[model samples]
Target: MTQVTLDDWAAMPRNRDEVSHGVLVAAPLLDIRHQQAVTRLAYWLDERLPDLVALAGVELLLAEEPLTIRVPDVLVTSSTDLNVRRISPSDVRLVIEVLSDGTVRTDRVTKFSEYAEVGIEHYWIVDLDALTTRHAQRP
Candidate 1:
């Protein structure tokens, strides 16, 4: 299967795709449990952390040249770049991914390493089935 690149993915009129190492990864519709997890987390962040912006399904840029990008289930960013099309890793304060069956490997191994490598302050994973949450802080 041929996947779109970052530029093409971004330019498309409607996009629900993420780029990992310049290859577009199509995002499937989230199940109710996954959606609920994201909504609850976003609400909690909004209520408790009024200083930061909490949003669901925001595109985050990890690298420029290789064009790696991810659409976190929930992302917390400072109020600085409110209207930008895509978020830079540096601006990202926290990113949360509510896992589904298809996303287990990528979210755990690939995204875990990538988020840490970029120095994002915090990364969270919510596994509804396992009823577990993992929070990783970059050092």
Candidate 2:
């Protein structure tokens, strides 16, 4: 059987929910709690990073075919790419994943490695229940 790659997976309509650590990432609906948390944090970051743009409910396609991964939550990037299409993970400078019971590990471990591998400058994991956030940076 042929394996599906991230790009192929990206082309396929996604309607099923998947687990990304402790977070439950579902299609069609974006989580309210996660949205709120992202808003608050983005506001905090905006005060400092004036040239940066905060994006919510956006898709980050990290790979093509079977390796394709779409991240939901928040991302910080330069204002220039805000109007562009199909932003690649290579262009992503920072990624923030809000933690929930279904996808916490995926955020903390899986995505951490993936983001680092893709050369993302920073990765943030926010634990909603704990009311805390963890930031990871790559050198």
Candidate 3:
């Protein structure tokens, strides 16, 4: 199979899919609890950080060449313009991923490393099953 590039991923229809290191990964549908978690988080962020915008399930471009694109369950950014479909990591202030059975590994490992590598200021992982939230900040 041919490797997928960021341009190729961007051209495709917006769906529950992500590209990590040029590999396509399918994301499971968000359940009610998952959706609720994302909503609560977004709301909290909006209230606390009025200057930043909170978005759910938005595609973010973390790297280039062998592209890495991720769709965080919740994202907080200062970017006001919505014309761009994919946002650079530098523009993002925080990335939140609500843990689901199908995405635990990717969220905790793959995405964690990717986000850190790109210098994302904050990363949050919300575990609905455990009813907990884990926060990580770049060192």
Model number with the top TM-score:
3
Q: Rate the local accuracy (lDDT) of all candidates.
A: 0.81, 0.64, 0.83
Model 2's C-alpha root-mean-square deviation from the true structure amounts to 4.6
By TM-score, rank the candidates, best first.
3, 1, 2
Model 2 / residue 18 / CA error / Å: 7.3
User: Which residue window of length 10 is worst by lDDT in model 1?
Assistant: 130-139
Q: Could you give the candidate ranking by lDDT, starting with the highest?
A: 3, 1, 2
Give lDDT for model 3: 0.83
Tell me the spans in candidate 3 whose CA falls farther than 4 Å from its real position: 132-139
Can you write out model 3's per-residue Cα lDDT over 19-87, one digit (the tens) per residue? 877889888987898888888888888888978988887889877778778899999988988778877
Clashes of each: 0, 23, 0
- In candidate 1, which residue ranges exceed 4 Å CA deviation? 1-5, 132-139
Residue pairs with colliding backbones in model 1 are none
